[model samples]
Target: MNKKVTILNDKHQRPPEFSAGSCTVTVYSLQPWWRVDLLAQYQISSVVITNRVDCCSQRIDGAEIRIGNSLENDGNNNPRCAVIKYTSDSSSYNFSCNMIGRYVNVIIPQNGTTLTLCEVEVYGVLGAISLQTDVALGKIATQSSSSYPMFLAPFAIDGNRDSNVYAMSCSYTDYYFKPWWRVDLLIEYQISSVVITNRGDCCPTRIDGAEIRIGNSLENNGNNNPRCAVITDIPAGSSSTFSCDMIGRYVNVVIPKNGAILTLCEVEIYGVPAVTKKINLRVKFHTSEDMIDSTTRHNVFQQFQMVSALKLYWTQEPELEHENKGFSDPSPVHYIQR
Candidate 1:
């Protein structure tokens, strides 16, 4: 038997002898392909392929490189980046594939063509960070209605998308009615995006026409909030992400009609919390000697501008407090920070 699986194990050394030791057999089949799982999604920049340095280096020509998140057809049906033409002896070929995916596949469609990959190097950055902010997990979840038993309102925010168990994986609302679900972020945030998971077992079309709304208002059951996006289609047991770069305290998903059912497996929010900054200042004068003359008053005003934290605007002449035996108090100066 030939050890055909040795080519994918990170051993790119030139074969000392051609005996199926570090190379795959050149077989005649339309389904000859090799796949690499990146474990997570990434904004890929390029892919590097190292060809076998020994004999049969020409077999890698015409091979296609594909990248995508789908596992359909072993990822061979994904989008193609480039096709390899030829490589010199003991050399590698580089292909720029600026796409986002978790799987990379190498395929050859012609018969009698063997797909051999000595080594494959992928370079990319974390795609999720750029698309969304920090994860809004462990927040409060509620809904307009529930179906009782196990399909409660809290399942949508529990962070589980598996529809196999039904009750635990998804939350089902009563009948085909105008149902709604919402999450409370406790405080206002600059929302970046929202991800929703659809039921996988059956009736995936129940979530069609659902509208996502975000705002700081709870009037009309949070349905009156600003509309973000409307759901058109989502694959069964899959999640779809939508961008909502707005400021809000609530995220609501509601079906406007009364005949449509609502089933959501999971809901995730990403945003940044809002914060306020407070500043305090105090000024004191000891005696009238502090401002004995007009020159001393000018020096005091100039010193105020030197303080980088304060921005002074010379409006009108200061109102001198002549009644005080201590330093004369000037009219309050109005200023703002830069």
Candidate 2:
């Protein structure tokens, strides 16, 4: 009977409002080239969500999160999803999901807290893409010196000839083993034909069977000789001119059966010329194994310049210097008379 006057007020305190202060959603594409058709796949490792709330008084029993293109519960059925169980003391929670879209959104909710959203982040892995162009050797011209063989006419070859010869044989003991700078030739009689042969012991193998083109045509043997060539029927005792498309150390020429006198003109050949134009060489990182380490890369660059400096010096006779000095020395003066 005493309980009739007792009344208790039960106030239902609204559930503690919980909210995520800041959240970050990052996406990364592992492929080299981004292709939508490939259905982009990614590893979402650091999917962290931060919440600003008091964990001591109210405890968070559970958390619900959704990430995808659409915001629905099923959310476009994105192939990726992230869920987290957080406590009041938890500072940040991380989850991972894989999806194939250019955009993604993350929604987070706590049992006793208001829903929070993080800024959307999009990421994708693309495949390596590159393009390469062929190195081009521009038009090359052959020039003949004024002292060209009077019997040889300056003939141009378009590189069609089989045994085409633009120069005659000449030997320099000093340059026998070393590369030649240039060649000069003089002919006294009319040159009937020209043929080039590899005569020097150190002739570059790359020169063998190489075609010499003039303008745009090939220099070919009109008679189908084993060597590529061009023939001219100049009259006897007359001078003709000829030139070489490329500078080389030595070239052998075949005189006609009547054998006319041919002189070695000036030769302009030497080691590979230094590149004056800009050149770009790029290296890409494909994998840990394929990556070129710093040490190895530096060594390669150093070796290139070292080899370029090592020029080939031909052997020479000691007597040649004595003779040259004798000819070049000026007359000795003992005393002057007034």
Candidate 3:
């Protein structure tokens, strides 16, 4: 069978080169900084920065390495992974981040400071599952705006938390005012918790400050729903569960601010659906002789005894042992998406 999947990736791209003149760059400016976008999200392990070799290596002292998804403050507002107290001549310094993000930034907080770098290397592992009673599985989902067709909303409910958008397992929205994401549970439930997996390959910080709302109202695209919880943070390549005891058919994750891009690797809802526990089906079948007749419409219910109704309750039988193949997607499109 033909299938397609986005797998984990490694550092192979050439490091970005600034080619600074040891002391010429970032001169006489407040919060002088530089940042690079990796185009997609990943779990950043560490960042390697090479200082200018020609001269003035001291200019690189006190530079901070910040890694996160947000571009606020020229990406300098991102979480500080490490800070450089000092740098020696023309060498490289490696700072461990262990965060998931798309942007890597170097910032000098001091005014009238100079920042220079010869090269910036970001090392990370890309794209990487659990069975779930997740009510949101295979449910209809949508977002404010998709960055691309490949990062549509439904992917968040596809039952995969690969955390890599390239894996086609994460949902992404474009930069917009108060960007939001929602899932239609189809029925109201007393929700207990929400499990969110941030983008592992990059930009995991984008999920912060988002509000989890649950209600039946579609006002403001379900964003005006009753508040369940406000997310503070979730590390990259990590799954954080928020306890939300609320009643609603729709669940929304909205970043209540402008210039925001919402992303979700996976959203699983858990609760008792607003329906009866037991299920029953009753039916009447036509006589075989009448069924064989092509033209006549049979009314077997009036002429014959009705069959007993079948009753069933929620339960599961032992599942057959199956191979654990790495699979994550909805419709596994074999053709490459253009």
Candidate 4:
């Protein structure tokens, strides 16, 4: 059916300007079986004509592409066509037509439509390099010397750079002794620098300090715990080697042999510097009878009130000597002491 469609700028029937050369015309059909196909027959160098669907269909079974043509199975043998003829430049170009149906309508840019150019680029790599290190403070033997190593993983992006290393330790026990600990970190290496921080409840009262020993001689000793200590400014990816000696009294308090099970209370790392950060350390120690004695004191005090109540006098005591004399011996004093 041949129908005349009025293209208006508003619902009030206002006619808009229709550009002459390379103008885009969009055709929409209300019929359920209507199919449309767009093709660019002629190409223009400076201008391009494109068509797109605008509105969508409300029908549940209907679907459409808003910017393209419809690819529906219609009995009509003649295929619908949207032809674009370029009147300006003379360059043949490729055109693409998307499908639209009851779900969508079409919209086209007018001849004088201004278009801007856009560009995009992407970049990526196959692999990346990373570095990591882990430090673990080991247990120090009582009245004996023990050492633990801090693991270091030296990695490189292109090449390996040998770097210097340093070790650090934090005291987690509360024992009456120097709040800080020092180990002969380096045996023969020179310390470029050292930093320490009093972590945990080790400050305000105790002066936090450390002694750096190289081989048999002490390198440095101070009361200030450095936050960032560096033996040497090594390469970009290197490590340092050092140890710390935690100086504290052994938590070995002997208990009486007859004492009960003793719970070793928390050991306090005393003498911490005032500037130390609060840190909690876990220390495992053998229990002693002193702990048992303290617990016993608590238990005895808890039953003290009940025991005191039982001691109140409720009855008079009998005089055993007078009662043994029998009724005849006492004479007039026959009645035993009441």
Candidate of highest lDDT: 1
Tens-place lDDT digits, model 1, residues 1-338:
11112134356553433454654554667758888887888766567777775667787766777888899998987765556656464457666544568888888767766777666677777652454343546777788777575877667777554543355857777765678988888888878778777776677677889999999789987889999999997645546667888788888999999776788887777778754343443344444445646787787778777876655654544444655454445555667532
The residue ranges of model 3 lying beyond 4 angstroms of the native Cα positions read 1-132, 275-338
TM-score per model over all chains = 0.49, 0.20, 0.44, 0.16
Best by TM-score: 1
**Candidate 1 pairs with clashing backbones:** 287-327, 288-327
Candidate 1 C-alpha error for residue 121, in Å: 14
Clash counts per candidate, in order, are 2, 58, 10, 51
lDDT of 3 by residue, 244-308 (tens): 87888999999999898888888878777654344322323223333323243233222322332
Report lDDT per candidate. Answer: 0.69, 0.26, 0.68, 0.22
- Which residue segments of model 1 deviate by more than 4 Å? 1-124, 127-135, 165-167, 275-338
Clashing pairs in 3: 41-201, 41-202, 42-200, 42-201, 42-202, 43-200, 43-201, 101-202, 101-203, 102-203
Please state the error at residue 329 of candidate 3 in Å: 56
Candidate 4 per-residue lDDT, tens place, 1-338, comes to: 21112121223221212332222332442322222222321111011222221211112011111222233334222211122222223222112211112221222223322221110011111111212111111212121111323211111110111111232222222332322233322212222222222221113112212232222322222223322222222112111223333322121211112312211111111121112223222222222223235464344334433554222221222121234323212111111111
Over the stretch 1-338, how does candidate 2's per-residue lDDT look in tens digits?
10111011122122222333332222322211111122332322223444434432222123322333443443423422333344455444433322223224332232223333232222333322212110111112222222444212222212111111333323222211211111122211111223222212232232322222222112322111233233232111111223333322223333332312222222111123222223232222222221135564445345444655332221221111135223222122122111
